[model samples]
Target chain A: MGIIVLKGYMIFTIVLMIVYAVRHLLFAYNRAFGKQKLYYNDIYSSRMPKISVLVPMHNEEQVLHYVLDSLLQCDYDRDRLEIIPINDNSTDRTRELLDEYHAKYEFIRPLHRDCPDRGKPAGLNDAMAVATGDIIIVFDADYRPATDMLKQLAIAFADPSVGAVMGRVIPYNANRNMLTRLINLERSGGYQVDQQARYNMGLIPQYGGTVGGFRKDLLLKMGGFNPAVLAEDTELTFRLFTNGWKVIYANSAECYEETPETWEVRGRQIRRWSRGHNNVMFRYFLRVLVTKHMNWKEKLDGILLLLVYAVPFLLAVGQLDAIALFFLHEMDILSGWWVLLFIGAYCSFGNFAPFYEIGSALTMDGIKNEVYLLPLIMYNFYFYMWTISLGFLDAIADLITGRQVVWAKTKRFTK
Target chain B: MASDHKRQIYFARTYRHLKANRAECALFLLLFILPCLVLLLLFYDELTWVMTNGAVWMIQQAGGPRAEISAGTFLPRLGPAYYAVLPTTQPDYSLILGNLAVCLGTVWVLSTGPRKGRPVAVYLSIMLLIHTMACAFFLLGKDLMPYTLEDFSDLYIKQQIGIWITFLVLIGLVMGVLGRGAILRRMLTVVSIMLYSFVLGFVRYVLFLWILYRFSVLYMPLMFFALGPFFDFLYFVAIYAISTNGVIRIYNTKKKGDWVWA
Candidate 1:
């Protein structure tokens, strides 16, 4: 019975890996060869919606000025734009810096939060209460948006059905080190291929926490951002999709953000992401299944995306199961052609982003030499597996104990 | 901020199909398919013989007296193939207990260490887990061990063949489908990967045999699973990435206007 169970699990893991491999391959192929479903890039209106750009800062004194100055330089109409840098219990010079900016430009509003109720979601909730804009855009304190970023993100709201818009993130410090270079490859593959392909297929395109915006009224109507939820962005995505709204991906709405320059920082960042994403997964997995707003394809892709954080944990367990089978010497669970299938699936499973997907993305992005860093991403497979699995366990513990999730920010490396 | 304008080209450009490159596509197909056919039909015997002889020679040099090359038929239809046969070392009771204690001690230390959540800790924990399992198997299920040294060698040779064949086909498919380069560049990429795999596989085969001959069969599972074809894919990806980078550089330099805009 034990052998049977192990063999069955091994087969199941292989199948899941194959599904993801095929999904990635299809996305890559579509991005490379298929006709792209265009974003609302050309849609211009004389009367654009009032916009509030929220920059959430917590002890982000090191890099607060970059985002504020960038926001000041944006070409959005001054009468229609408001820059609110939410100072969420920051200790350093962040509050003072924001005050300086606010004094210089009345449009730059600094909301200082010294209360115990902190974090991005809570800060966003408080900021949204006072923001007069119809559409609210969010960026991390480390991000530097282009002059037209506000216009690019806000244009998607012109479509009544688009509840949220996610922009592409390009790493500014990609040339820093090996870790940063690998992360740049991951970001490129993720946005250039994965998000765009999903949008092209009319499937679910995720609204990442930063470099994105949503309708303030719609979020307020659904009860402002849940302070208890760590991943307010993913939660908002599912809430909008399940409520007959859409989240569009604007590939052209590109923004520059800093990626973690070290493995330890990257590990913590991914772990927190996994924890928050898994929490959202647990909250919305069932809702996604029965939601009438989404079609069959949307539901399938939604479930797969929700389960993305959980896969590394599952694969870790699958590795242990393979070891058990090896020890038991019952390795011939599937013979003949199944062996070949198993090998193919295992190859795909070894790397989270398969070679072809990353290759296709680099080819399309016109990136010249960074393609050489693709192999270094293999080390990230194990790194992410362990960190993500630990985060999965943390999420499980959170559910069992009903503990409050504390949001941990990724440490800024920009000096 | 000036780089922002240059960055816009990444998304602003359009893509059209490489319709004029049909001849290159045909060449890619031939490059991918022909090598596998030739390796299987013409060079199978010579390849297996080289692997077997190399392993046997390495084992003898590493102080294993009884190592020899042998032949076996994995599939009756494929005829006999060469494999290395080495005497298997059995662990004594004291050695098993000592190793088991050491594994447990290290795992306990790792679990309680300050760097508990770090990657090094995780890797060590995993390695200790495998070693512990091996110690337990030798201690508790010595007679139940399924594979002999000869059996392992045969399986290794068979799997190595499978890996080479798969690498050829997979690299071809990846280059053919996603690779953007002249046909010669793409073919060179495939050849580079194949050559690297052969060298890596040969070195690993000899190293595994040397370790097995010195150590007991307890480490067989580790060698087979942990240090097996899984690590081979690492260098395979590295070579492929280097080759792809070269292709991208050439395209950007010489064929800048050939970009298919979407």
Candidate 2:
């Protein structure tokens, strides 16, 4: 009976590993073999879509100026562009910063919210009520987009089916610390390889909240961003996909973001992400599987992607099974032929290890020297598994107890 | 039209030359020959010992329900040792032949590629093919004792682990090959193979197999059920796809003339 339970655990672990590995492997394969439809130079020659750039902020005085300055320098038509920097009851100089920018540029429209409602989704919803542009682009205060970034993101709207467009985010202060460096690696793999691969393969390329835009009408039609969900981006992505809309990954539309510079900050950020993503997983795992519009490949990729944040928790549980087996003197079940399987599992898991993904990403970017840092990701993996596993547990508890989720802001270091 | 004909004639000549080339033929043969030698060298002593004097512990270690061994089977007198009792079960003949076909087929597919293609892809694929076959040989031989005794062993387990390790290595290599620069790609290829091989060695045979199984299962679903019940028929298909397409990517690349075929 104990042996059967061990076998069950082994089966579960094996299936999870295969699913995740197949997902990443397919991404890698598509990035190699598939034809890229979205290119930076493939600019739309049609009429430019009117874009309302929404900056949702809460006491973001330190970094707001950088984004404002960058927005002012954007190589977009002033008549068609509108910038609405929302100040969600900030006690700091955020309102002053917005007013100053508003006074200088006609496109800069400051929206100061004095109401009790806060958080990014609420701010976005408030701005959506007043935004006049055909498309709405969202950016956190820390992002410094390129001059033509808006142009690149906006052009994708020319394709009627493209309901949303996502731009790649690179970290400016990556060299500041080890935490930032690791974040940089993660971003590169996430955007350069994973997102691009999904886009190329006709799979879902996620619409990240920041540095991405969606049709204003579409969001308004769907009742704006869900304020209840911490990961409005993931929620929006699934909503759009389920409704038969496409989200494109604009890889060359690179914007700079200030990554969390400390381990504590990074941990908080990942925990928030894990919780939010798992929440979406709970909501969309079956939805993606049951959706009729998506082919088997898209459904497969989407479902695996939804459960990605939860995999670490599964791995942790499997590790427990291994330990129990060891202590229970039932390890003899792993003898002979089972031994090869154990080695294969290790290799399979190692292939999807962030080390390999980051190395591959770095190699693609022509930065060969950074590949040396790949081995360090083992530590990063363990750290994430430990923290995110806890986040997974918290998500489950929240689901069970019907607990209200809080938005934990990731503490940023401007430098 | 004349130029096309000439090109076609040139390709035919190249194909003929490739097939008859003593070096290529020898390399093809080596894929089978080397594995056999490695297996013999790895397990000849233990196998000979087991054949001459049946391991009492092996029979005892058969903790699960024991099955019958035909009196006239090939288990006891392994290759006419003429030393011990003529009793016990024999390894499944189909399992041995199937594994042999897979190893040889993998080598054949990897070795033969487009005459003109990326050198990096060819070199990397070759390394994976050779290393994988070598590991398969070692792992297969390591399980020979249990297989011969039919001692609560499953050949499907051995094959799955071997094939998955090879697939993982190939996938990593493909990622590396798609990377920028010949030097970096080559470095990554060697480094990846070495790192994976080292990890495989660190855990030894039995532990390594299970760990391999664990990771494969962790990354995928329906692995045990699909590959287990189907007896690895689909696994062979995947291996074929990975090896064939991996090499063909080099052929398909625009910058194909850079690397010489290995």
Candidate 3:
């Protein structure tokens, strides 16, 4: 009976892994080989939309100035643009710095949330309430947007179908350490290839809260942002899609942001993301399937995207099953003719997170040298299995017990 | 109006292509359907034996026919014939049900495809038939064949390593074919194909799991989720690609576009 149950779970894990792997592979393929290049054009006319840039900061005194300064240098029309900086209960000099910026720049309007329930989603919700622009753009405290980035993002709105537009995020201090380097590869694959391919395939291109813009009214209609969820970006992506709106991946609208400088910081960030994303998955998995607006392809992609955080947990379970099977002397079940199938599934399992996806992204970005570091992802996979599995447990506990989780922030480093 | 007209023309062209491929689709579907049906029949007896015996094996592993491991933890135990092709005991109706569902669900999905897609579905049935035969051959080839876990593991590892080497060689050949032609483009294509192939392989594993669960009811729930998708993947790799490329080629020809055959 225990064996039967375990076998069932193993099958469940392998199937999900296959779906996840296939989705990423399809996206990568469409981005690489699909003739119709989505977001490949830089043909934005002089007709720019009214843009409201929301910079969400929480005790971000270390890096607020850099982002604000970058925004100040943006090439968009000054009269048409408005910058709202959300100062969410910052005890440090963050509010004071925002005040300084507000005084100095005519466009910088700082919102101070002195009350409780302070996180990025909450900040975004408050900022969205008063955002006067036609298009609402978001930037994290550490992001340094290129002058033309706003224009590139705004241009996508020219097509009425585009509910949101996301730009590529390049890590500024990527060369600082090995952790940052690995993060850079991940970010590159995620944005340059994965997101791009999804866009090309007419599938879900994630609106990664930072360096992404969306229709203010659409978000407002979707009941603003869910403050309880950690990955507000992923939640918003699904919401947008299910609501008959599209999120465009503006790969050319590249912006530089700080990645975690250490493993501790990276681990915390991944955990929070996993917690938030899994929460969204529990909420949206069925909704995505039954959503009237989405086609089968979109639904498949959305569900696969929702399961992204769950893959590591599944892989970890697969590892445990392997051990259990080994001790039970049932490991031979994966031998002989089954070896090809097992190895194939195993390869697909790794591809679920790294290697070929990252390699393709790097190759597309003209940074083929980093392809050699692809093997390091084996270690990264194990790390993800550990952290993400723990996060999955926490998510499950929170979901089942109706326990509210405090939104833990990703600690920033000053470089 | 121009865009609408172009779309209409494209649809007309696509219709013609599908019309042309109907015979091929029928022929392909017919080729595999008989074998698959036979394989299904053969699977019945094997599945029954595995369920009854594998349950006993499981019971033995747990401690004995009447023994149970501590409820909280999964107590891993080795049965006497752990290396045998089929392992399990007790008749699992779920495996039989799941297989029935997969076979029917796959046929239904394939049948629902565009005119051009029906043939592709037939092609996928062929792949599934191949997978079925492989599983059947393994089970019936040598009754209750046993081996050491280490020896099996070594063989598996070596075989996988060889596959990787073969994959590298294929990529190298692709590069040679390109011969200084769009280096970045070719490299990205290779990477994408490699990743996509892994996904395809995983889908194949999913189907294998469906087949595996037939003899072992231990993981019946896994088979449930694996059902419709096994067919979906089989269809995707076998038939979907061909029909899509065919339509694209026909359209490209109509537009006098580059006849770049992939």
Candidate 4:
């Protein structure tokens, strides 16, 4: 009873902390990072460089056209732009779509990188190696990027030291269902509160594995898409930071993509991502952090980024064990203390953080009470997916066995 | 001189008006001072008798006032540990009456309240007081005051003492002033009750232990806070009752009409 109470108490603490965050830190994010106060003329400066768009696709026969159309409407200089569509071992009519787009547009350069369709990272590397542009922008198939996304990203890179600029990926069909709405909210909170907070705190912002821009030279210099891990994009961006490179976040520059709607699909996707990113971090996070070039701020952020996904596994197991021993009447109080402590921690810390910002944003988008669906979030997070365990195991195995975490191209939802 | 005298008279009038009708204020002072007075004024034997009588009353109310029972008779029953909602066996009349009185008391407090949030505070404070009182009564009902007042072992005496302390603290807090002034203090009292209930969180502990002892972790949430549906159902019934009986009575009385068809 004491142990269970202690855990319940700790978790309750976390709940309080999260409540505090909601009350204090998030009331006025607009005030803190509010719309940058930039003048209209300042936004459309002629000095904005043309960005090269790179999208590597395989077996995305269903929704490639909408993506291409959205890309074709790029709000940058059409003549200076390049869109390299790398085809890698598609058994579907994906190659046909690329060729059809190629015939229609001069900027759509269809390239076959099929010998190793191992993943998007390999295709990106193969295409990126031969790309001829000042700035490299990567997008996933089924992506419907905002027209002015190029301008938003290009403005961020004017800082010169910015190695990459990561954009937001929201579910294309946000108003689909209760589940999708919840997912949109989660994404908002992560992007708006978590990532945005990290950005403000001078920490390394996590680059989602899609719709990110990189300095062409800097990307290759840091070894573009090492294909050694599944989340090659995150791997490279973090690596760039470790080597004295900085990333600029372009929140307004968004690419709408498909989110896994069902639990089965969502679980598998999360598992793969967890495994891949953990592999990526284990490979270089520590070494880069300790490196002579990296700053303390970046190093600390790197560790936080690494520690991000370990809780689900820890929480699930700890909760189950505590439940068992507490009933069996034998386990020591110290045995299940971490689980309690973790609950206490997240609930507390979450209060100050914008963990629910995305959901809040969707609410702002007229999706009300999305914030109150915490029980649903808990149900899905704890019961359905154990992403952290998958992450840890993958990292260790990749370390010991030297197995490459395969890069999986995310399919978009435009069609 | 006449002007100064008139001004002083006005000030005195305002002060007197402010001082009038402060039931909450009187209650606040008494909560702290009365318990100690009770302990000090009564002789030791009388005090013990008083304490035992109160415990006995609580035990009897709880329907578990055992008398001179052997250890063999206790643990053998209640069987294995399990989280079960044993049926509520109180008579329907008592439940309805107690519930009515509680509701009427709440309504009276709220209706007479001066501040905007005072009514809600009063309602919440009463609910919390009932909940905490029920908990303390049950846990300590088998103690020396009630246990030896009935018959249990000499063991668990210290725990009973601890339980007694929690009860006294709860009593003082529930009835005590939470903040400055009467209405704010009352509001604070209500908030404090809900806050304290949350902090205690023993309900969760007991339920989880029951789940672990009986079923499995898979059913833990279902067995526990799955009260969302049940609470909603209760709220519906409570609404029906309030609307049918109390609200109608209050409305009729205020309107100067036949308050009760019955």
Best by DockQ: 1
Ten contiguous residues with the weakest lDDT in model 3 chain A: A334-343
TM-scores of all candidate predictions against the true structure = 0.90, 0.67, 0.65, 0.60
lDDT, model 3, position A21: 56
Model 3, A1-415: lDDT tens digits are 8777766666666566556655665555555445434463457677688999999888899999899889889899998899999998889999898889888887899999998898888888999888899899999989999898888788888889888888888999988887788788788778777777777678788988889999888888889988788888998888888889888887767899999886666767777888888999999999999999899989988888888788777776775664455334454443322323333454434533444566445544545345555555544554566667778888998899988678666678884
lDDT of 4 by residue, B165-214 (tens): 33234224322421222344343443443333322333333333333333
CAPRI quality band, candidate 2: incorrect
A1-415 in candidate 1: lDDT tens per residue?
8888988888888789878877887788788767788888788778899999999999999999999889889988999999999999988998898899988999999999999887999999999999999999999999999999999999999899999999999999989988788778888788888898899999999999899999999999999888888788899999999999999999888899999877678888888988999999999999999999999999999999999999989888988887777667665343222333454565655444677777777877768878777666655676788899999999999999999888788899887
Of the candidates numbered 1 and 2, which has the greater DockQ value?
1
Which residue ranges in model 1 land beyond 4 Å of their true spot?
A335-352, B1-31, B34-46, B57-82, B93-121, B139-144
Best prediction by TM-score: 1
lDDT of 1 at A300: 93
Error of 2 at A9 (Å): 1.9
Q: Which window of ten consecutive residues has the lowest lDDT sum in model 4 chain A?
A: A31-40
- DockQ of candidate 1 is 0.35
Between candidates 3 and 4, name the one with more favorable lDDT. 3
Candidate 1 lDDT at A129 equals 94
